[model samples]
Every structure is written in structure tokens, then in C-alpha cells.
Target: MDHALIEASLGELTAANSRELERKCEQIALSYIAQLVEPQFDVDSADFARDPRLICADRYWNLRFQAAPTLATAVDCAGWMAEHVVAAVQDPIREKWAMGYAFITRNSVESAAEIADATADVVAADDSACNKAYFAALYHAGKLRANFFYDELEIFLAASPLALAAGPHRESVLFTALRAFAAFGSRTTVHQHGCALLDQMWNSAERTFAATDVVLNGLAAGKDFDGRAQLLRDRSAEAVAAYPGRDILHFRLATGRWMCGEYDAAMADIDEALRLLPAIGWRVSHELLQGQYLARRDAIEAARAADRQARIDRDRVQSTEREVDRLAGEVRGTVLRAVELVTVFAAVIAFAVGSLNVSLNGNITLADRIWIVVTQGVGLLLFAFLILGGSWFIADRLARRSERRDRPED
Candidate 1:
């Protein structure tokens, strides 16, 4: 029961269609029976009645072609089918997932729930294979939990003797793969939520086993739920006592500390895990957790930058407004002063020509005529300058207003 081997097999099963995966499962189980310890008891025809996989497969195959594959219809068919298979066989979890895959692809959450519920009970009853399937079912439940009628998934963390004896070295790998699958779904809004639960369940399971390098790395990176990080730290201490100079549990313990928001402790764990990870291919879970840590760090930095920019923009706007007000006030005073000067000049020119009767007679000297003419000419030029200056000021103001109106709001 190498968790890694089973994980690889499950990967094949997941990617394959229902029928194909089922066939592969049957072949593997049969091969294991053939090669492993020989059977002592007889498998009777009546015992076949107790064998549920055969019964389930027979029933589901018929249901597939008969109906339009509604959620209810799929469940009804798959439930009865899976029960019979598990009842007759010692471990039918893998076969059940294959059945679930069929129903899931057809959008039958009910059928998957039926099998998942059954698998949970087996896990509680101490079936090692059931534990694996329980996590798998949790993932399916998350993926297809929309229907209220579907049963809820319950994850059992206690160790079973059958499971402990089956694959001492491999369960972690299985845990890793299933967790990745569950996480893949949970990453999206529309997918499964069983990922975190599965991670928790496996973390509990890992505590009962001998600590390995891969397991330690996962713990150090905080791959499990928050509550379990402390447990991993304690477990890592045990690993150190049993296998001194090993980097496996030390890194995991550090990761647990990190996940618990102890950055300094996490850094220490990372340093140790890095020392050991090179011995084995770095675990995928550790890599993903590292990515998550980096992503959060980036998000925090971005938020700080945005806050700083907002303050700068606010100050700039206030300064610009004050400058505009000061310029507007100066322009207004200058315009009013110009109007008053033009009025005074007009009155003076009229008084000189009319009331004073200062005439430039044709028989008078040229210097007198030139002085009178120059005075009138200067008055005319000053009036024209005032008129053009006012027009230019109005035009410039309108142009600025138009530009502001055309600009996009922030």
C-alpha cells in the first residue's frame, strides 16, 4: 500500500473514463490477490451476492442508457450499485470512486454522495482503504455539494490497524495527490471545498506514522489547518528523537510554526527543509505553499504602494486648487484696474477737445497741431488695447474650461 503508487494509480483512474478506470481497478485488485498472500477461505456464489461492485456496475450501466442522467436518477442507481459492491468485497473504495466518476461526469451528485457516505462509515469502522476513499469522496462532495439532498461528507482522522499495516511508506504520497486534487477544485468558486478538510484528515493520519522527509517538509510549510500546526511540531520533535540528524521533521515543524504566523520559526524550518529537500525531489505541496507565501507578500506590498500614491494625489490636488484660486484673484483685480484707467482716459480726451476747445487751426504752427493730434492718437490707441486685452482674457478662460470638461474624471 505505497501511498505514492496508489496516488499514481488514482491519477490514471481520474483521467480515465469510468469504464476504463473500473477495468483497471479490477485488474489491479485481482493482480494483488494473485500475487499477495493466498486466500484461505472459499469465495462462494452466495458470497458474490454480498459483493457490491459487481452489483453496482451491473445496475449503473443500465441506468446510464435508460435516463437523461438527472441528479436524482444517477444517485438512486449509483447508491444501490455501490452498496452491493462494498458489502461483498473487503475494500471497495477505489471501485466506488470510479463509480462516482461516472456519476459526476454525468452531473450526478446524489450518486456520488451515496458512495461517499458509505465510504465514511467504512473509514470509521477501521477500513484502511476506506480512509483513502473517504478523502476522495470529500473532494467529490465539495465538487458537487450544490444539491441539498446530497449527504454531507464527514472526515474521520483516527488510525485504523488495516491502514497502518497496508502501506507504512506510501500513505503520505496518496494524501499529497488527493490534497492537490481537492485544492485544485477549491481554488475556484465553482469547484470543490473538500480540499482543506482532506488536508486536515491526512495531517491527523500522518501523526500516527513514522515521520518521513516529505512529511516534515509539508508541516514546515503549513500545508495543514491552523489547529494542526502545533501537533506537527510535537511530532517533528519525536522524529528528531527517533531519527537524529534527519532534516525531515525539523523543516515540517518549522513550517507549522510559520503557518501559525511565526515568521522567524518558519524561516528556520525553511532553512532546514531546504537542506533535506535536495535528498528527495521537493514535494509538490511544499512548492505550492511557498508560492502562496510569495503571493501574499506581493499583495501586501501592492496595497502599501496604492495607499502611498493616494496620499500623494490628495496633496497634489489641494496645492493645485490653491494656486488656481490665487491666479484667478490676481487676474480679476488686474481686469478691474484696466477698466477704470480706460474710463479716466476717455473723459480727459473729451474734455481737452470740447470743454478746453484746444483746436489745431489749419493756419497755426505745425508743432501745435502735432501735439494736439498726438494726444488724440494716444487716447485712441489705449482704448483699442483695452478692448483687445479683455477679449483675449475671456477667450483664454473659455478655452481652459473646455479643456477641463474634455478630461476624464479620476
Candidate 2:
């Protein structure tokens, strides 16, 4: 982001003749647009980031508003700060988290302020300050570029207006916090800052707001995919708990749970988001959140249908594999049975040949020899029949047993 255009535009605004200055803020507005369309830098480079939105500084805003709040001076002061104050900038204000944060922050301040008005209702530390001083301070904060988490916020606001009217020699604390939270920073510092920002609901005027994306994105950037998911999920859940029934909060929470890695849980969250979407907030239909959410619903439903089919296919494959294993077992058993039968027959033949040799070697009559041959032949035939009949009987019994199991009994 070559912010030379911002300084140059501010200078141009000062030099414009009365008539031209009164016409429009075309140059200042266009300068911001041009920066937005600038070509992106490499990710590893120090300058590689979407530029933060410009904001008005707190300096001298009190004095200006004290006289009379005019639109012209407000624009002039904003331009002046962009030139002089390093920046009172924040990340762009479009995240669901940021939008939801804005909605909740606005309500939280109002609710807390109301309690502060009533002596008996104040319980929590954040809302316990019932003094007019606290209300006055909060009023000032809301009126002119509220930094809800400024260090020594009370003392700074209590200080004399003239003392607050100094040129900023360094970056505004908000920009510093945003920069640290967004890009790479010390792990411990980023975590501490992110958690602190999460705790405090932010309220800013339309032009002067800090984007919660600075914290949300920074926290996510510090971690890997699953860690990022869990962190966002927990944070969004906390927000939902604090302010229940906000549709945007539910939408953000589901997306955070997140990113479809935990399929079933993520799917459930998406369904809830789709169910809770509101039916309004349209200026141009194209810009409406409802349109965007409808498109998202279509995509999520498609993903869910695909997820269902994938599980069905997986189950079918598992079932087929089990059947294959059973068939393989039967084939293995048959092969083992055949090998055993062959081995037994071979042993019986060897013994019969040995006995015949022994009988022939002994001195004996021709008749004796005939009798021995007949007996031996008969014995061999009987042994063969018995062995084959035993194998057949065993196979028949096994088939019957299997058939019985396969057919359900009446």
C-alpha cells in the first residue's frame, strides 16, 4: 500500500478553491478506491496486506464537536488525521464476525449503560460503573471515534481539551494493536491482544470503527487449519452464549466449527445457519446478506448430499470385502483337505508295495503266492473304498450343515 496518495489527496483538498471544495469529496474518496485496486504484493513481503480503512483521530474532535457538529468539518478533520496522525486505521469492516460484533457491541453498550443508570441492576464489573463521570466518558467515547479499550481511557478523557490537541508523532494505538493482531507478531502478544479484544464489545461511529477482523484474522493466522477452526469455534460460541438468537452469530459460529473438516458437526452447524437466516436488510438486492446466504445454502446442501453418497459407497465396499474374505476361507479349507487326502493314499501305496516285495522274497509254493496276491489285492481295494467313502460323507455333511444355516427355520 503506497499511502503517498492519501497524503497527496489531503494536500489537494486544502488547496482547492472554495467552489471546488464545496462541490464534492471526489478526490479524497477516489484516492481510497485507487489504493484498493492496486496490484497485490507477494505474500512473503512486508507490504503484502489489504490496506486498513482510514478513520478520524480523537485529537481535537472534542473541540470541533463542542462548537457544532458539522459534516464539512468532520470530513476535513478525517483528512487531516490521515495526513498527520500515522493512522487511526483498522482492517476492512465486512467480516461476519466483525458485523456480528458490531451488532452485539452496540446492544451491549446500551444494555450496560442502562444498568449503570439503575443502582440495583448493576452486578458485573464492566457494567458496575454507575457514576455520571463514567456515563459522560462513555458518551465522549461513542461521540468521537470510540476506542473502547484505550489504556488509561478515563485519565485521557478527563484531561483538558487543549492538552489533547497535539500532533501525533507516532501511530495511533488502535492501528498498532490492529497491525500486531493482523500480520505476523510475537505469539504471546498476539494471543493476549486477541483474547482482550474478544472480551470487549467494540462501538464506533459509522466512519470511525475498528474492524474485529484485525483480531479474528490475526488469531486464526497464528495457528494451523484445525487450531484455527477450534479457536474461532470457541470464540464464536462464547459470543452466541452472551447474545443468544442473533442469526449472524449462528452463521459465523457454524462456519468457524468450521471449514468442513469435521464433516458431521460442520454439516449440522451449516443447517442451523441456513435455518436461522433473516429475511431483510436490502438496499440493492445484490448487496443484501440474504442473497449471499441463499447462495451459501445451495452450496452447503450440495455438499451434504455428496457427503451422504460417499458414506453409502464406503459401507457397500466394506460389505463386499467381508464376503470376499468368507469365500477365500472356504477355498483355503478345500485345498488343505485335498492335500491331506493325497498324502494318506501315497503312504498306503508305499506300505503295500513293501509287503508284496517281502512276501515274494520268502520261499513259498505257487499256490501260496496266488493266495497272497489275492488277499493283498482285496485288502487294497477295501482300503481305497473306505477312504473315498469317508471323504464323500464328510463333504455331504458339511454341505447339509451350510444349507441348514442359509435357510431360515420355520
Candidate 3:
């Protein structure tokens, strides 16, 4: 409501109570008590003798009447009654929370002290399950409401807090609206747990970044889990193949597959990397890598053979271009490796020349001879790797093949 209208209403409420107004206040209190408790019995009429809620609620209103001296105070008691009754009736998890509310508000002083004690005992002293639940609900209510606030603050920063206060107040009201709710009993606890997990979040980023994903098939928000994982695996494989020397890429790809929960494929990458371990020059491995593939034991081998063909649909799609690129990478890697080997040979030849005293060549010092050798070695080594040395690989392969053919069968 606008400020002026609200101001006028407040002025009317403070007027002295006449006989008519006092009777109205009594009616108002009775009406609220009926609405709160009668609904559960599914009766139009309240049986004061039979219903405990009606007994508690009615007594609560009378207690307010006895305590309140001013007419406005009586009206305020009527309001407080309405709040509790409505709380019980309107709750989604109604009946229970509402009944608790009514029972607690049955006496104001008792409730105030109960709240204070429960707040300290349940929160500080560690109370029973029920009291702790009240505290948990309170904490969740406050935290979730604050989370909601942090979200809206990004956009509607200009709006008053009341704009968003209506919602998220159903279960709680940033703990403020607990007065609107009815809290009944308090509990005393013995001990509390130390190491416990509360929940697992799909997105650690927390603010609408709901999940992790590799880009291609679908976002993490989509229902296509398999599709997202397939894309992630394919991208990882492509990356690994393109840079085979980065053997750690195998471990990384496996990690992504593991996240996808594709156990076999993840282990396949690791197993394959283990077989293709770097040469002695690399010196990386001192132990075994994780093999998730071996997780499928002999028992599963039977199941796999039976279902393997049927599981064709589960295989990740391999694009033609990606495969072709992988092959091209292999070709380039072979050429690179050969060039590296030739460069080593050239360094060895230079070393050998440095060790010799080349007196035959105009009595040149070893230093001058080494420099001459290095200058020629670089150019010839470059040629040996590919320009003139392409034939070397062909000859070597042929010689190996001839030797294999000539050997006796083992």
C-alpha cells in the first residue's frame, strides 16, 4: 500500500475500544481459532472439550486479553492469533508446522523463552533431532533466502527488499517470519557429528553454472548425458592424437572419460599409453598408471562377449576428418623423430672431429676443425633427415622385411 493509506489505517486502529469494538475483538479471536483448528477435524463447529488445538488457541487468545490493557494491544493480540492460525493452515507441510505454531503461541511468555532456549540449546548446545531440525530448517531458510537475494541483486538492485520477500518465506522468512510460523517444543541433545557430507552439487560454480561439459553435443543443462560425454571423449582423443609426445594427454583424456563414467574407454586410454610409453630418453615412468579397463573381470568378460555386438550403439562417433588428422599427425611425427635422430648423429660426428688434430689440413687447430665440421654438419644433417634421406627409411624397412622372411619360424 502507499504510505498515506497505510498511515490512515494505523490511526484508525489506535482508537479506544467501545463495547462494540471489544465484542468484535472477541469475535475476531474466536474466528481465527476456529479457522486454524477446525479445518483439521473437517468440522464447521469446534468442540472445545475434544480438540487440544482449539483449547490451546482459545486459551492463548484469553491470555492475550488478560495481559493487554489497551484496545490496540487487544487488536494486536487478534493479529498475532491470525498470524499463527494462518501459518498452520497455509503451510505446504501444513498440519504439522501449523499445529506446532498454534501450540507454541498458546502462551506468549513461554514461547519467547522457548525460542530463546531453543536458539541457544539447538544452535549452541546441540539439541535433539527435532530441535536440530528446527535449526537446520532455520539455517536453510536463511541461507537459501540469502542465495535468492544474491541472485536478484544482480538485476533488480533498485527494488525494495519486500518485492522478493513474499516468496522463499513459505518455509521460512530469513528467520524473521518464524514469528509467523509456530515452533512448538524444544529438545536437548547429547552430541553432534563432526565428519559428515551434506550434499553433492552438480555445478561447483554455484550460480547457474549447473554442470561441467565439453562443447559439441549439448550443454550440461540438457538431458543428453551420453551425447555430452561422447563429445568430451572425442575432443580429448583428437587432442591426444595430435600431440602424442604429450603422453600425459592420455591421462587427461582418461580423466574426462572417467567423469563421463565411461569406465572402459577411460582405462583404454591409460592402458594404451602404458604400452606406448616414452623411450628411455624420456625416463618418466617408475610405476604403473591407473587401469580402469581391468575393472571388468573374468565374470564380466562373459557378459561383454554376449552384449558387445548389441552395444555398438554406445560407441562414440568417430568423424572421418578427425581420423584423417590423426593419421597425418603420425606421418609428421615419424618425420620429426627421424630428423631428431639425424641431428644427434651430426653432433656425434662434430664431437669426433673435435677430438682429432687435423694437422693434415694446413695444421689447423682442433677448434677451427670443429667449427668447419659443424658448419657442414647442419646442412648435410638437414638433407639426411628428409631431402636426400627419405630413401634411407625405405631401405631400412626393406632390409628388415627381408631379414624377417629369411629367418626360420620360431
Best by TM-score: 2
Over 4 Å off, model 3:
1-38, 42-196, 199-410
Per-structure clash totals for the candidates? 11, 0, 3
- Over 165-208, each residue of candidate 1 has an lDDT whose tens digit, in order, gives 22432244333433333333332322224334334544563332
TM-score, each model? Answer: 0.28, 0.41, 0.17
| Residue 312 CA displacement from its true place in model 3, Å | 23
What root-mean-square deviation over C-alphas does model 1 reach?
18.0
Q: Model 2 lDDT vs. the true structure?
A: 0.42
In angstroms, give how far residue 97 of model 2 lies from its true place: 14
lDDT of each: 0.44, 0.42, 0.37
Superior by TM-score: candidate 2 or candidate 3: 2
Candidate 3 lDDT tens digits, 249-272:
565566557556665766666666
Residue-by-residue lDDT tens digits, candidate 2, 216-287: 434444534335577677766765676565555555566665453454565566566556654322112223
Backbone clashes in model 2, listed as residue pairs = none
